[model samples]
Target: MPTALSSTDEPTPYAAPGRVAAARRAVGDVAILFQFRRHAVRRRHLARVLSLVFCAITLGAAAVPALCPGAGESVGTHAFDIRLLLPSAWAGILVLNMASAIASGGGRELISREEAAPYPVSPTTDHLGALVLAPLNIAWMVQAWILLGSVSYSMPGNRVVGSEILTLLWLVFSTSAAQVVAWAVEAVRRGAHGIAITRTLLVCLGAGAGAIQVSGNATHLLDQVPTRWFIVGAIDGWTWRWAASVAVLAVATVVAVALGAVPTHLAARRLPRDEARMETDQHAPRPMPRSVLGILIRTDRASVWRSVPMRRGVLVLAVGPGLVALAGDLKWSQMTILPGLVASGGALLFGVNAWCLDGRGALWRENLPAPATALFDARMLVLGEFLAVASLITVVVGGLRAGLPTSYQLAALLCTILVVTVQVVGGALRWSLAHPYPVNLRSARATPAPPAAMVGYSARLATSTTFTSLLFSGCAHVPDWRLPVIVALPCLLWSGLRLAGTRQRWQDPVTRARVVATVAA
Candidate 1:
């Protein structure tokens, strides 16, 4: 045992260089710590299994063309040469990645800043964590699938494998580069008048893109994009060129990863003025609602609109994919997919854990002299409205670019939007009641659920919504108008049954208490 020191004994001073070296050595350990904590807090066997299955599916999709080279060749003839569009596809994906990163405030966190406040986790760790979690977004995954499918279909037989490799490299490079840009954007947003400046910049960018499209220079501009070199190198099948491109992208990825930390450090040191302002704003009292349900609805709406994450998420969900559709000049058949994507993203914002939006206030809300069913209905109503507004905005934007749709196409699109919204709302409410998680959505980087659980939620939502969109897309081809209605009825009925079940469960005192206690914690 060591001898006890007197009051005169002083503590040893650590060398600055040694401390720095030690911190550098320990930076990566934070990821391991988060993983351990996550697994310990919740059993993730199911999430892991689902993740593996998804990976297998992604690989299988990519391998199809290689396994049977003649399969994609049998597809229907295209109106224009698909090869010329390859560069645009690549450039579009890169833009989307960057936009998503920026919108998400540098991507989702493995462990939120609030949760990690007691620890010594560094900004570098946060940057790494964000990079790791970036792939969980449904938009990112869907675009990646599209990229793979496009490359396999566009490239010649022998060059397909090499092109696919290059595409994968580009995906990695783009994601890393996007993270760097996102960190820089976050840093800027935390600066003076950051919100106004960022909003103005976004408007300018959108206006510029629109002007280019309107001027008929979209194709000419896309052809001149640097991404064309990747396709060209693949098509040429020149080993030296391919190797050089890979080497450059790899080195660039490393550079991006290192450069991202600088902004992360700067942003972390600064106060998030936008979030602070939103949280601290004083709202004047509104006139009282006649019914208890109306009061609850008002509160829920305010909760959603006030949250930084929800606002940013809604804006991104409303605009990002719609802009993509507009740029691509997607046909009515393709436009059917936009609503489902937007609705799913909207629901994931806070609906998946609806009660958590109230945080500890959920307990107070529950104690109010309101019927439990009224409370449930109010939450579901707000969620549905949120999803509907976001999805409708997306549809309206896409419609600007898509010329007049036939009656059948319009009917199919409308039914698809309504059905998908209902289905997503029902599923989200059911999940919220069945498996509630306490989430603080005040921060821009906060997810509505745990990262792993979000992965599962996003996967399920994406599958169902995508399948629904595809069905509606097919229905648009049919001349009969009643076909969409007939299909939508069953979907509505199924979702209604789900909502009824969730309501019944929520009405049970025991279940309600359990949910309230969990979320209020």
Candidate 2:
């Protein structure tokens, strides 16, 4: 070039008329925009909505104390445990470090633009950019923390703060599972069992350690203060508790870091390309079913059974929430949590699948011939099966452990009513939130859920109102179980109506679509 083009230089009008060049540029821009739109829809938009939700919940729940915390003096509690503070700070530091590492490794790109020209590309630069982005992610996390922190403070701050170590441990384990799964998949795909073996051994060691810890806990060695020990830490309570916690955390961290390495590598290798393969490859299952509910159930099953990674995820999700309830019952001797917490959590854990999963591929299959009733029926049946089994277990355990017969009777009726209502409404909402485009067979996520937000909101509102009405209308202060008729009536009526609604609505495409979009959203 006799005269190199500069930023100030405007290109001459196309004398040769390069149509292909113009077309290429236009196409590229469109592709980029589409990717950006999807990313924005999933990341920025979703994050904002979730953050807002958390803030609202926190504020609303906080105000509830002023409204009511029920009879009996509410004893506000707190403890200054320096030992805990140190570990908590350390855990936070670890979180920041992990966040930075992920950011540098291109996880941030999941929600950002590609690098422009003039930026030097190197390992150091990649890490630097990630670290820079870390602050943004940390900010979001801090907002989230504030939201949850408020809830914990209002409900159980000490427990929540102490539980940070546990939460972090679980998060680490989750990271490990995700990574272990990815590497296992990739390893299988690439015919490399070596990585798989390494992963398996690490997992086994972690499991073995867990068994030992559990045994120790059972024997009271894990929760008791160690005698004949020189204690230098800033806390009193129990050296045993701290020792067990630290050991558990250390094990979890090791496992998490070991597993996190794979996903990081995948991101570095290029996530966009890999993600496409994940979403649209022939290697995955062929299209499952067309109906929203059918799709959701199938997807849920697939997540648990199809891939080794998702299977692990399902186990954790299905089991993890109940862990605290179990510990509480064991310690408190008040099976208040048995049916109330475990049953509901397990059912909801399985039930929420209907909202997002059921709505998958709704657009493409809307015209496809599929039985609406069967779709809804099958999904509810499976979910109900799980709930029924858990509920039975909870009821039996709760009945035995409850100190008062009246409490047991009351709890049983309350639980029965709640489970029945949940079965039907949960089914309907799950089936209704189906989005058409970018039909995710997995259906656990919504890139662009169909627009039934209003209906879904109404469903939740109605459910809430019914619950409040049942409780407020002389039910809340019922110290003894007298009106079994009242409890049974509401429970039975709600359950019947819900089931009827699901049966009736499934056949109506418009109704189903509206519900799917709203519920899924």
Candidate 3:
């Protein structure tokens, strides 16, 4: 000012060196928070992961009493085996986390195409931010809780700190490993290959691996040594061992980060080109099938086959029976429950997402002369056919495995079919009509149904399954009489409720329009 300096020529205050770094970190943190919000929008993903997390914690907590030392006894210095119970419970969680990450298009930064064009942050910073947030996923929390339970039951109060530190290191390693797998999968997707075939094969392999891990002691390989060492170290209060484990884990983490960086860099480069191309492709009009029923079936079927989220549900239907058969001792009680659970469970899942899967296509369907009931019914019809086929196969195979008579198997199959049909059609359609939501149908990226809708749908399925379970159990017992009545009562109740909901939704054009508009947007 003394020299009357020009506006651009004024001497600037020297920014503190630490302040610049801190400001950059703050920017990255905000960017990640925004990404997390967008990532959490899908209620379906959260529901599944939450349910599994609950189950894992429940199992771990339940095991604590059994595993804990008796009162007045010092915690054992000997190693404990988590392979017996914890692996199967936690494996499902790990698989779900990995699958969800891959479906959501990998563990890349949350910046959108518009913001990413200029790439405000360097790739190194962007990737680091993503890795930091990777563990923030609820799945990592599930793993953390499992470790906490393990440590609490195995180590005395004074030694818990070292155990917890070890647990944290393991969580970091697991999250980093899962992120690496996700990045690798995303890289594959962006590679020059048939997307469908590669993805389908990958899905199958993943499902198979997850099943093996869940149904068997596959995690024994990972858990056998460190788990034992950590338990022993915690019990012995060996701080040096804990420190050494942390050092090893740090080295491993650096290696994992380096390995993951390749894929991250590749995906980042590929994402812009692929996303731009996709944006162009999305602008084109899509062809609708002739009949309303055909449109419903084809559209839903295509989306299920093409999209990873829908495909995952479908895999549950297909893989569950085989898993049950292979894993079970094939006793009558177990087999009797298997068919109904698998059949009804699959239908319940399909129903949960039935209406939501329509996505932008809802706009086209809404303009049709047909009523909402017709649309709902058509969707149910497709689901019903699938259920019928899957249930039949499951019942027959399960019956054979359990050595049940043909007549009994038929009765079980018929009962399951009727019960699932009524339960899914009525409960699902009714809920769909009552609370319709939209999702991205065309994109292969996973989109979860709304949280409220998921909760409602889950409640409906649970109630329906309870009634249906009675009938299913009755069928399994091969009742000489009263099987028909067993099935018919719930069927009638479900159908009546379904009809009531359908009619209500059908009569509300405003709600229907809202659903369509929400989906289109």
Candidate 4:
């Protein structure tokens, strides 16, 4: 029997009110997500964690004197040791990085990207609705306040705490200044060159500080240098050294900001679609050159050299070693490991972002004429270049002054270095591939990548550290062998991030309450 007009066959139960409500809910959900991010990025819990961390450090520092502080009056009084040798080596490495950047015309020159004429689009008018207007600004202010609070916590007359705060201030200048320079350079000069200029300037600042000591010593203007492989040595706090150093940094910051703000031809002629939003225009690297390596891989190396993200990634890993090594005073041998560590660390970090950076294009490549191996090889080559530069500057100069260990010892050390680095890179790659990081930035400063990215990186790092520690138990040469427990530890960090991101990508929208914008007027 024919049923009376079925509701399914006729118009379904749809209403305008429900549709409108759904739309509102979608927008609300987005707003809620943004609020959560604001809190996460601000690291509401970070202050507490940092307070505890610093307290532990301070207590340990205080105990040194009461417990078993070195009786030596000054670093110079001590014979050549790791402390003295490490910094000297780091200084050398920095000088080399600066020289390479300057000579290459910047990191851009080292790694090239396509360029084109700029569209007549104005950034100010393009974004009509909600956007991240001042992420960097918010972050910067939070960091400033954090620094102020941390320094305030140290006991009165604690020169170490004061010096630490000042160094952090310099970093603030560096990041801010870089933003200004990059903006101005892109505005006026345009093209990849503008980016290169900023990279070179930063590299110079980092390298120059270390090179100064070497130069002074070479010229006999200074009798000795300061170094400790992994720590910043005690500053004189007694006189104008801190003020002078601060003044120099301040001047540099001012100059960079002034130069950066001025508009340039570059602003009018940035790389066409390539420099625009990357997600909008993804392209395959041009054909491979028919050369020695190219003959084997059937690809052009230069075309695949993506320096910006990868190089910057490398720099992130390098930063820890770079800062730690930038100490004063040292012996002959301690410097060697620092450079190796820097180079390998950077490469591993880059690997995490590699597959993701490849995107669909990379996947296609993996499926086609070039395999993942090819891409990996080319990327590794790039890593090698960075390592050579880092290690050459770090190891050679530092090693020479710090003194090299016996050949076998050096080999073991080098092996350890490579292994650690590989472990780090592998872990980062696994993390990045499983999860991902936020690439879009309103400012030039490479703020913390997505929290997921960091979490992944940390997980991998921990795993890697443990594995390498255990595998090379004898080579690690640390005081204790128990540190390797991290290697075999089971974890689902990358899985968690991937799951969260996927859920966020697919979840239904919701309506939410609003909050006031928290940024400077």
Candidate 5:
């Protein structure tokens, strides 16, 4: 039996609160630095070097147009003025940033929640880490380059310097604001009936935007956009108004960053009901497949569909860019690029680490008495089918807005779909075999590879796909339909050769054992 405590021996009531506060303060304050250190330690030297090199190249590309004389003057044709395009470009970038932030259910993480579970990683830390990692995305980087290029090429020579500064500030402000909104959205999404509420809100927003476009109010809206002030301020040069605008944006960015943490904290406190439900739900067994290949394909298909990230990514890849294309009413020449972009995004979902979908079960999978080639074939088939379906959806949606195509245009578009799907499949399989990382796809925020490696992979894929699409885009202009067919043959042959090589490697017993061991571990 314990005796009642005397006044002098009473327990401190504030002890638990004090400890919690201290842990929160300690981790959130240095979270970015800690994450950076961990990443640096884990990442390979070659990947680090490649990422740095890519950043340098991207910066140089963005800067060149501004530095070159007459670049801005050369942009406008007699039919279209550069100034008229500025507001739209600015608006597009902001929309892209917001869409990206919202789609990831806030933003992608530098360190996943599971990894941070051992530490008292505060919500503020999680938010900041997401912000830091946002720029790693290929789409984000491409849009940034476009925004900078547009600003550099549209502004007058003397005004270019001021406009560039203004544009960069706007980028910061927009990204911060988007993050704040994303956090709020995530907070709401974790509440009761949140998924339905959020889905309804998104649908409403999309419908309203579509209505605005359909009713011919888009131009009127564009004219009244706040981005116009940035242009006006920059063009006027060295004025109090310009200085004030810059100051306001800086303050707003600070405010947005701070405000984002509030919602992040709230959201973190609640359970992720949707993800939890998904992970816990039971599934009825399907009828048995007749053959080994059929069973393997069915298993792979289920894996792709069941994973949160894969499902979300596939939906976004299928729909997001297509909506953009539809709104713009892009021509066949321009539409040829969509398939490549869609395919690249699809491959990034899980194709790059195709074998890792099996996770620790890879060893069990390898021991099954089936032909090794059958396993490889199943994965490839599933991946290719996944990509092809997404690419087809994008094309169909965009084609609704695109005018009827000429023979040459039609051939180019059809061939583009085939060539890009094959190209991505071959490349993805090769990378999956050569460099596989074990990643759990159960988390909505999980990446198929390490962030640093993902950067490298995305860069290579973007470069190759963009070039291939451009080639096809150019081919769409030729009068003869046969030109596309002729061009596609070489690309198909190259991709086939690569796939064959990957298959050969997969058949080898030693290499197969090593991959199985690594992924399983």
Candidate 6:
């Protein structure tokens, strides 16, 4: 039995360092388990699993160079100069790390923040600790270790050791800076208005980046700078040069720590205080029409138009056409790619997660006397209409910019659009059935669909777009019969898409049950 005595007596046992460390580890392990459970229970568990497998493969590749003797030199030297490639690789990896963090819902755990708050850790330290332990950090650490191995492979003992130490230091600095960006974005996205403003700014910035990319001005500017200087300057055997490089790195790290710390503290401090707001302040919603198509349209409009991610996703679909029009020298063939890309992108944005948004409540629709297949068909119909309108706008704008197409060209363009639309719709529907994940309508940040789905859709779209563009580019060179064949195949395909989509979406009881369970919950 424990007895509380005087006021001077301690109320509880002090948490020892070992106990504290063990508790932190236990909490982290639980958090990881929770993430796995969350993904496992989703309809798209396979996609999430595949995504994890892919990341593991990537990390494995990075580790091989470091863990195996002479492997780095063998690969790095045979393919390219290790020294020359290291700096660029480091910079590229840093960008990749930040993108991954953003894509993976910033890979942050708010629970860690809450847990650490009562401890001796300050907000800044808590922020840094979260980042350092984050799964995303594994990628960058592998990159740093790979660099160290490359240096060890190419250099003598002292230089190798020095380079390794410097690489580790730089990795910390770069990753800390990335954490700042991630936390700040998370803070902004914690509010509806902030998400809208941030996403709009992002779209504007993306347009600017696209313009710069196409103009080749950035390449030209980069060429003017001697990028190899830092790599070459740092590892030179000269003691003074090495010392200067180390000094420069030290100064940079210090500056980076400051940069990362300030924003992190500010963002972390603001995050818990942010009161999430919804975008329900629309002008009185339009009255719902009686038809199935009308009901589907209303449901989707309310879901998408008010949501930040869906709205922004819709906005991004327009970017393809804008870029095509703004292109300095647009080829007729290149103009063909815009419609397919836009259609595919639009389909992917809402198609994959729409069913999941209705979670558990979907069973309510089953009781309405309308077959589940009808509901699915109605959804497809509504989505098809949206894609059709967007595709038409893109084609019209592109054709106008290209100057009115001749009869043959117009026919070819129309055929291309039809083919793309059918393929995109069919793919989206099939993919949606195969992989749906729960999404919260009320959440400030939109649900992050599995990375595998995003990558899979993008790759398929890019391949199809490229093939169509190249095919159309050579239309004048291809036999006349081929154009007629191309026109006929898509029309035939379009007619069967409905039957195919229906079969995939509603054919199996298992699939229906899973979707029903997901929707109802």
Clashing pairs in 3: none
| TM-score head-to-head 4 vs 5, winner | 5
Q: How many residue pairs clash in each candidate?
A: 0, 13, 0, 33, 0, 7
Q: Where's the lowest-lDDT run of ten residues in candidate 2?
A: 227-236
lDDT for residue 135 in candidate 6, whole number 0-100: 36
**Better by lDDT, candidate 6 or 4:** 6
lDDT of each: 0.83, 0.41, 0.57, 0.40, 0.82, 0.57
Residue 479 in candidate 2, Cα distance off native in Å: 11
lDDT of 2 by residue, 333-417 (tens): 2332333333333333334445344444445444556566656666665555555455455544434423444543555445443
For model 3, residues 1-521, the per-residue Cα lDDT tens digits are 37654535645565323544744675665566556654656565655675676567645653453355541134343324432333343344456556556655565344434344553454545455556555443334445666567655545555656656665666666666667777777777777763665569877986775666566765455455334554455455667876777788778877776677677778766643334344455434468777767766775665454555445455555555655464554644344455445555554444655666766667777777876666766776776766666666665555454564555545655665666666566655655655555554333332235333343445456456656666566666664435645666767676777666675765687877766676566
Residues forming the 10-long window of minimal summed lDDT in candidate 4: 512-521
For model 6, how does the per-residue alpha-carbon lDDT over 1-521 read when each residue is reduced to its tens digit? 76645445554555233544644664565565446535654446665665586567545543444445543353335323665566665665566556544443344443333334454444444454445444333234445556656655554443555656556555666666566676667667654466676678778977786667667785454444433454565466556766676677778766664555555555555532222333535367676698865676677656555664454455546644554454434545556666776776676566646576566667776677665666777776666766767777766655544675555555566666666666666666666676666544343223324434455556566576557655655563343535735654855476466647555657577897786676555
Per-candidate TM equals 0.91, 0.46, 0.63, 0.45, 0.91, 0.59
Q: Could you tell me the lDDT of residue 476 within candidate 1? A: 96
Candidate 5 structure quality by residue, lDDT tens digits, 1-521: 87766545646684334644744674565565545645654556776687687678667755776666556564455212666678777777788788778767788776667677776567877777777777777887777777777677666677767777888888888888898988898889899898899889989998998899889898898888888877778767778778977888889888887788889889998887668877898999989999999999999998888776777788889988788888888987789999999999999888888888998889888889999999999999999999999998998888887778999999999899899999999999899888877677777767788766777778788889889999999999998999999999999999999899999999999988888877776
Identify the runs in model 3 with alpha carbons over 4 angstroms from their true place: 1-172, 194-239, 242-261, 271-303, 306-309, 328-332, 335-353, 385-431, 434-438, 450-488
Mind giving the per-residue lDDT tens digits that candidate 1 earns over 31-72?
586666567546678767867977886776676645544433
Decoy 3 TM-score against native: 0.63
Model 2 stretches astray by more than 4 angstroms: 1-263, 266-310, 328-371, 386-489, 512-521
Please estimate how well model 3 matches the true structure, expressed as its whole-model Cα lDDT: 0.57
TM-score of 5: 0.91
Best by TM-score: 1
Better model by TM-score: candidate 3 vs candidate 4: 3
